[model samples]
Target chain A: MPISLPPPSEEAEAENTLAAIGEFGLIDRVTAGRVQPATTLLGPGDDAAVVAASDGRVVACTDVLVAGVHFRLDWSAPDQIGRKAAAANLADIAAMGAVPTALLVGLACPADTPVETLAGLADGLWAEAGSVGAGVVGGDVASSPTLVLSVTALGSLDGREAVTRAGARPGDVVALAGRVGWAAAGWAVLARGFRSPVAVVAAHRVPEPPYAAGPQAAKAGATAMIDVSDGLLADLGHVSRASGARIDVRSGALEIPARLRDIGRALGVDPLHWLLTGGEDHALAATFPGSPPEGWTEIGVVTDGEPAVLVDGRPYAGGPAGWDHFVR
Target chain B: MPISLPPPSEEAEAENTLAAIGEFGLIDRVTAGRVQPATTLLGPGDDAAVVAASDGRVVACTDVLVAGVHFRLDWSAPDQIGRKAAAANLADIAAMGAVPTALLVGLACPADTPVETLAGLADGLWAEAGSVGAGVVGGDVASSPTLVLSVTALGSLDGREAVTRAGARPGDVVALAGRVGWAAAGWAVLARGFRSPVAVVAAHRVPEPPYAAGPQAAKAGATAMIDVSDGLLADLGHVSRASGARIDVRSGALEIPARLRDIGRALGVDPLHWLLTGGEDHALAATFPGSPPEGWTEIGVVTDGEPAVLVDGRPYAGGPAGWDHFVR
Candidate 1:
């Protein structure tokens, strides 16, 4: 027997449009069903959330996404945008070997925006925060011509020392704990008008950073660490310049995920380009005093030389430079 | 001999534009010379800022400012934008009767933005946060077509009860702790193509919230509270609806600064319009059981009736309706 389904509009009925729903109603809908971790003493519903700083210290970071610039409405759902914003900020805290505790969000959009869309965005933020056992503690709402989301993440170190970009030493092994260039390859596939038979599109919409690996790297005595929001070479270059060391990536040892390669082939682009130049993968890259802990892949080595990045002992420049906010 | 002064630009030279300055250098400049309060165990320069929730809890809020919608580039500088953004969020914390401890900022701008512009924004945020003895602990940077700033503030209650908007009772006295309608009058002068007096113009640029007044009210047994970011009647309406009380305002008793009245005269607009309908003034409004604290002025009384607000026992209907995100 066939089962009857509710009409599409009814099944997806929103109480009111954002204009009709108003800010307070939209906020209530967005905050429902979210669980606050123990670290968050007070969560949503108040003016601000209070988070526990157990070690008497906290780490914080923020990132902003603008419609048309960071994401297109046609390409990404509001939920995806919310998750990506939270992930990006959380990754920064992870890069410092800190465990995320709470997040504060700032959103601006036109009044006519659907309340359901805003709710979806809030759900995405809650989902991403849940991944790290955190909560969306507070947020702000305002009217604007376009959609803009600003996220701030707070973290606790659990008494571990913070790993900075300035501490990589000569002879240290460079290792990575997550996928690189996957997001970039996905972007290339979309940009070049190629339909890839893979999840590259999903990767482009929502990046999955190695949240645990950051703290793990810190626990294992990594000298310096950074999240690969910029391209691999550009991000590693930060470590090189800060530590006054040369970083040499060994191409053969680098791991390029099969999905990325599949997309690269479909787009008629070299996967290596994405690996070297694409950013927003949020992979954790670190320099270790000895062999890194299990699950980390060694891709390069720190050498006592000029502050620069090299591929196979030579300066390589063959792809679009990594993400730069102003220098598009 | 009088020394010749170079152009204003020459006095504030930045070593690099935002793009040239890069993210790290810009961050360093934006965070230089600011001191953090004891409640902030850590400040900017890390992935996230750690603040002390001494009462085992914290209050947090966020607000965003868009270049053209919130403030015009010609009318306000980056510094003013920064101050306004911080003030908006801080006021939310104050509405909860909490003491602000730290701030996180997310900035989006074109790559060509001057480094000095960002520095000035940071300076303004620091200036405002400093007024409340708070610090800016973390932030993010991104590229957008226009300037967008998102700020999140974290606050502590010092083991006091949170004064929500749901506690007003019949026969309670309604009081206010800061100036009303100055910002609206200043905005009117600017909109009407008339130059306001310096004080009025400054009020329009940056609102000075009565920071200490919130905690003081909480200490003096305020029944309910809210900040006046959305005009007097509208914000008071929130208290009335939440607490199930009717609030009646005695406009004669309200302290409308003389500077605002003069500016209203110049603009050929009713000063009461500015006082009753103006927003972004960041004043504190609360309901008390009896007499208010030392500096607070009695503005109205709470009554046992349907949730509504009135002026002198009658409904007021003269000014433009209160601020609404979607509706104009």
Candidate 2:
């Protein structure tokens, strides 16, 4: 139901596609004059980029987005695609209670793709990463039928113990920091072929994850943490199983934002369902043994029981809340 | 002339395709029982994997391989594809004279793909990484029409100065370690419906880069270094331009390996051209101030001239020996 939007404009300075510009030439254009943070010792044009591992440890993860499946060119701009890619990977680092340091991109596009499309994508990537003080260090470009972006993010733990999903205790209090249901509501709006809900439509393009909340949660003695990429209930279940605890979320306690409620009301759908099952919000949900930090709203509690997530005191049974990448 | 062999036997213990298995289940199957290296502080699961960076600096790079473009499943096994993906990125680290520590894979494949194929790919990735004392620390799996592997390699400099391609000076001796032209020869053999060169065929599948020679060069006071992925002249040209010096390679002085010569004779192809322009060799080429240490053979001399590559006093005028990913 995504609304038909104009495709990302292909504004090529030269009348040449990726094939005409060639790989090295395209790379030269894509990476020219990009300022890097101090952590980037050696930048692009080298065999490998050298980044300062300030604390002698590196946290790493990777994610990929395939054209048509993860995104439709008709719906998203090149810059939005790039920004989403960076945000998706950086959110993983934040979920680990680490500060993101650098990103390496692996991009594939058809030979006929406009060079400006790649530049716009780079602009989006750099803009999002720069917002969090990270820089793109190295990447590879290849030709393919569809556009696929593979991004790997590196982060530093800053000498603190990494807050993992397996550390949640029975007595821990579950808390959430960041928006939920917004991206899902946005998706619904876009899916319905309506562009009136502009904010929600933009949210569907770029998720604004609360980056600082993760480290703050770690410092606040959070026992377990996870980023809500695959819906709140689904992701919370991960913490439940990993930590061998039962998580009971109070649906009434969730602070449903007024905008999300308004969007759901306009669409005649239940916003609560979106709050529980909406994916890609990238909100931080953690279990704190004591009172949670500021900016985090207490939403649930951990208890001794079978490892599962319960909504309002019972195991909520419905369609799966997480995204299955392989399920069409 | 790819001989269509039957698809890699689908030995999925659970006869389930990627969709049936689901993303989390597929990830578990793909990563189960893989032994990790000491460098992997945290492996898989949770948010991000933590890799030990002993020297306080990390070298990182990423590369993507698309099906039918970078590799063909009909011709090469999944394991071989995984190995090549790991090798390609690891070679970049080796080019920087860094010791590889870990790899993160971002894989996208069709839903109908057999689970065994992914397992085989994982086997190849783990085996290749293990050979270099590295580990597959993390990965993401998604769905796409064509198979794409986005591999990111992380390495530790081990407190040594990174040997960059831009450090070559006039009068430095150029040396090479590892096989050249073998993989290209294998490709040629396969292209012509002739696969008699068994070793060459295997070489084409798995590039055996001189993993040790890179570190040895760094210890031996080498000035500049690069991996021979894009052919000798093409890669050397990178060094030339970066260092602002001309590289003159003596064709007669090159010790053409016997197997390469034999394959060239059988195919009626010039081994020299393959040696000069053949891509995917993954060999280490370096510049040294005086005579290089053991295990490296001097192949050329750096001289004061415009940044370019010369073979026996002439600029190579043949077609590009290096790969251009966008070229059809």
**Clashes (N, CA, C under 3 Å) per candidate:** 12, 3
Clash pairs detected, candidate 2 = A1-A191, A2-A190, A2-A191
Give the TM-score of each candidate: 0.89, 0.95
Which candidate number has the best lDDT?
2
Off by over 4 Å in 2: A1-14, B1-14
Write the residue-wise lDDT of candidate 1 on B88-149 in tens digits: 88998898888998888888787778887888899889889988989888887877666788
lDDT of 1 at B300: 94
Model 1: per-residue Cα lDDT over A83-107, one tens digit each: 8889988998999888888888888
lDDT of 2 by residue, A1-328 (tens): 9999875455543347888788998889989989999989999998889998889999999989888877777788989989988999999999999999999999988888888788988998999889888999999998888788999999988998899999999889999999888888888987888865788788888899999998999989999999898899999999999999999999998977788889888888878888999987789999999989999999999999999999999877656766778764
List the lowest-lDDT window of 10 residues for candidate 1 chain B: B7-16
Query: How is the predicted docking of candidate 1 categorized under the CAPRI scheme?
Result: medium
